[model samples]
Each structure stands twice: as structure tokens, then as C-alpha cells.
Target: MNSSQFEKIKNGKGFIAALDQSGGSTPKALAAYGVLEDAYTNDDEMFDQVHEMRTRIITSPGFDSSHILGTILFEQTMDREIEGKYTADYLADKGIVPFLKVDKGLADQKDGVQLMKPINDLDETLRRANERNIFGTKMRSVIHEANPSGIKAVVEQQFEVAKQIMAADLVPIIEPEVDIHSGEKEKCEDILHDELIQQLNALSENEYVMLKLTIPTKNNAYKELIEHPRVLRVVALSGGYSRDEANEKLKQNDGLIGSFSRALAADLRANHSGEEFDEALKSAVESIYDASVNKH
Candidate 1:
């Protein structure tokens, strides 16, 4: 994608829907709609699954080649060696931009201190991945505490990682994910707003670097309205909802970008069943996009 197209994706209200089961019993049609399938397994069976996903996405009518972005898990892609490069090439051939998820899973924390070590040799890994011509990469870190010191530390870490990623010529999807599972909607909103402010401040301090997307939760409409445009180029919806519910939330948010988890897995299966699933997903996506536009 060109810089303009990348900016459009970054700034526009789009969807970053997932395809999480590339290695399992996933149906083909679902992969077409920007599914981030688990194509990282080394087993021959997993390779077959990844192939099926690739075939399905490339051929599916419901999948918008221009709008789709595919993600590969670091573990899966790294283990498969040449498979990683092949996967990137395959997605490019299908007109889909490929992204790598580069977090070391969730960190183990203790008494407000993260016990896990930072990702080592990140620069080297990114250099190799770039050689394969992957389009983008995402990295996530948790802010365990809502206090000022913790928030400052999280922002520092995020900015440092983002700088490193950008230096490698990779668009970073900086995710300071505040776990929604912990608090009520009101509390969640407060935490999210606080985090968003801090993240933007850090990005600004770094001369407002270019980013691929920012995946954040929807807490309050006013907060989103105020903060969305100021932070990252694109505002991405977080995971943890069904397809129907996710569609509904996207509609409600209007111009905001939508991302998913189980919804993608379910939608992929739905696509294999035939026309019903295709129509529903397409209609829903288009409708949300339209609604978001209309609101503005």
C-alpha cells in the first residue's frame, strides 16, 4: 500500500477484523475478511490449515481485497521459517497487507512490577521480517496500575518500542491495552481516557511519529470523540465480542474502526456455509462504515 492508502487506513474509520483459527477447523470464506489466522504451527496439519485460509481469502467475494489486512502470530510465523516469507508473499499477491503481532504474550507481573524481560533482539527480528516485505507489525504492553507512576512507566516503554519499530521501517500498532475484564464500563472509560492521554503525550514527545493503528476500547462517546482524532492515525476496536454484537458496536461508534476476535472465527465458518453469511457480514460492514460517515 502507498503512503496515502496507509494514511487512509490509519485515519479512516475502518475495521481490523480477525481470523484466529488458521490452524484449526476454520472454513475458507471467513479468512477472506481480514482474518488473523494462527498459521504459526509447525505441524503439517497446521500448514494445510494455513493454505486453506489463504485460498479462501483470495477467492472469497465477500472479502474486500483493498480493505483487508491479515495478521500472523510471531510464534507461528517464526517457527515455520520459509513459511513466514511465503505467507507474506501470498498475502501480498492476494492484495492483502500482512501484519505481524510482536508482543511476548502477556507479561507476568508481581506487586506492581512486571517480572518478564523485554523482547530481546527485536531489531534483528524486525530486520529479517522487513526483508520478507511484511507490511506492518503490532506490539502490545499492559499498564497494570492506574496511578501516575505506573502510567508514566507504561508510556515510556511504549514510546521506546515504537521508536525501535519505526526505525526498522515498520508501521507500529501501539496498543496500551487496559484490560476491560477488570472494571465496569464507567471505570473502564476512566482508565482508557487516562491511558489515551498519556500515550498521545509520549507519541507527541517523539515528534508525533506515524503509526499504523491504535486498538482501544470504546468507553464514552464524548471521550472517544475528543481523543480519537488526537492520538493515532486510526482508532481500532478491541477484541472480545461476537460478530453480531461487534457489528452493532461498530454501528454505534459510526466512523470508528472495528477489530475482532471470536467474531472473526465465527464469520469465517459462516462464510463456508454460503450466501447467507456473506451477505450478512458485508451488509453489516458497509452499513457501519456508512453510518459512521453519515454521523460526521
Candidate 2:
């Protein structure tokens, strides 16, 4: 692990950029960026378009470390280049830590939840990430209900995979998101909070993990997890909330930072001119940054 990068994440004043939209979510991400489905006829073309979007965001003057601590990247994005440097290298140059999304998407929902599918060639992926100067990895699973068994299974699986990532000397962001729209959203978060603490308690004394959770219905709902010695940082995903709504809720949480995807890129459009794009991105980044650093 890079010590300097680790310190930055441990005490950084800004939010993480979730630019890791996967193959399954790329089309929707592109569509929101003003690149409609008709623009890309195949998967490769689709990815190319999304790559361009990512490249634009990474290279923008507005996307720097001053108000952005790190970026979470798709595996494909990590493998690709921005400007003359690899994506991770490019981020490092801007003083930003880069994390790779390592999950192979989610499996079909069972027991009212969805767990991550088996990650094929995970060792190879970790090796590649280390070679590229990547600082960490992020993987996700979802809980749609307050079922104790299902939530327990999700948390266990996340920690299990996270250990493999940690063994590679990279920090892992274990995301067991309780769906923001679940009928029992508060109950789901309460269960998830307990499950997470249990898993954190079981970690070896020297081991550390990061968490990415849905912004809870109640303020400071995961305060214990945020303060755990075993936890390095606790970040909140935007889920389906608009940027404004997400920011409002985020300010009420004292220790959490934003790891927003849709909300971070909400104001940018594919058809925007150079200056327009930069200004829009700057606006988005500034708002999210404020919400991250200025707690209620």
C-alpha cells in the first residue's frame, strides 16, 4: 500500500468519485450523459462512449485532488489510458488515489437480497491493479429487505472477498448496500449496521477495511461503523437520489463522505462545450465536496 495515499484517504477532506459504472450499467450512464442508445450499436461501442465520458471527467481541470480525494474505476477503465498515461497513473499524477471495481456484478436476488457473483481471476485482477499503481478495490452487494439471514449472508460474503483483496496489500471497500427504496429502509440499515460491526470486529487486529453504504434514513445511523478502529473510512453511495437530495442528507452525517456516481455526474452532458463541461463539472464537484467536509 502507498503510505501517502493511505494517509490522504484516512484524513482527506473531499469525496470519492464513483466513475466505475460496469457493463450492465454503462448504457444507462451514457444515456444520462446525453449519449443515447442509438449512438452505440454494440457493447464495444457502448464502452468506448463511456470511456470517453470518463476520460473527459478525469482530464478536466475541475477534477483534481484539492476537492476530490480518490476515484473508483471500472476494470476496463483501469486497463485503458487517459492522455498518454494509464488511467490509474493519470489519477496518481493529479494526486488522486485510484481504486478498481473488482466485483463481477451482482447475482440474481435470492432471500430478498443480491450477492455479488463469483469473481473470476480475482488474483490476476489484483496483480494488474497493483502494477497500475491502483490504491484499492471496491465491490458491491445489495440488500432489499430487513431479513437477518439475508443481510448476514451479504455481509459475510463481502468480508470474505475483502480479505482476498486485503491479502493483495490493497484496501477494500466492502459495499453491502441496503437499497434506499426498500420498504423497510430504516430496518434494513439497522440490520446492516449491526452485521457490518460484527464483521469488522472479527477482522485481525492489523487488518483494515473501508465501507460504502447507502445514506441511511436516519442521521448518523452508521456512526459506530464510521468510528470503528478497523474501519479506515466510511463513504455513502448516492443510490438513486438526486444530487441536491443526496447532499442534503449527507450534511447531516458527521463522518461519512460521498462516493456518488449518478449524482456526481448529474449536471454534465455529452453535448456540452469544453468550457461548459468544465464549469458544470466544477459545480457538481464543489457541491459534493462541501457536503462531504462540512458536517451538520
What's the TM-score of every candidate structure? 0.68, 0.99
Error (Å) of candidate 1 at residue 96 is 3.5
Which sections of candidate 2 miss by over 4 Å? none
Number of residue pairs clashing in candidate 1, backbone atoms closer than 3 angstroms, sequence gap of 3 or more or interchain: 8
lDDT of 1 at 262: 52
Write the residue-wise lDDT of candidate 2 on 1-296 in tens digits: 99999999999899999999999899889989999999989999998999999999999999989999999999999999999899999999999999999999999999889999999899999999999999999999999988999999999999999999999999999999888889999999998888898889999987899999999899998899999999999999999999999999999999999999999998899999999999999999999999999988
lDDT agreement with native, every candidate: 0.51, 0.95
**Per-residue lDDT for 284 in model 1?**
49
Give the runs in model 1 whose Cα sits over 4 Å from its true position.
11-13, 20-44, 47-51, 66-85, 93-95, 111-117, 142-152, 202-232, 270-296
* Candidate topping TM-score: 2
For 66-98, candidate 1 gives per-residue lDDT tens digits of 455444344354334333446566555655555
Q: How displaced is residue 257 in candidate 2, in Å? A: 0.5
Q: Can you give the lDDT of residue 77 in candidate 2?
A: 94
| Model 1 clashing residue pairs (backbone) | 10-233, 10-234, 19-35, 19-36, 30-268, 40-76, 254-292, 255-292
Alpha-carbon deviation at 285 in model 1, angstroms: 5.3
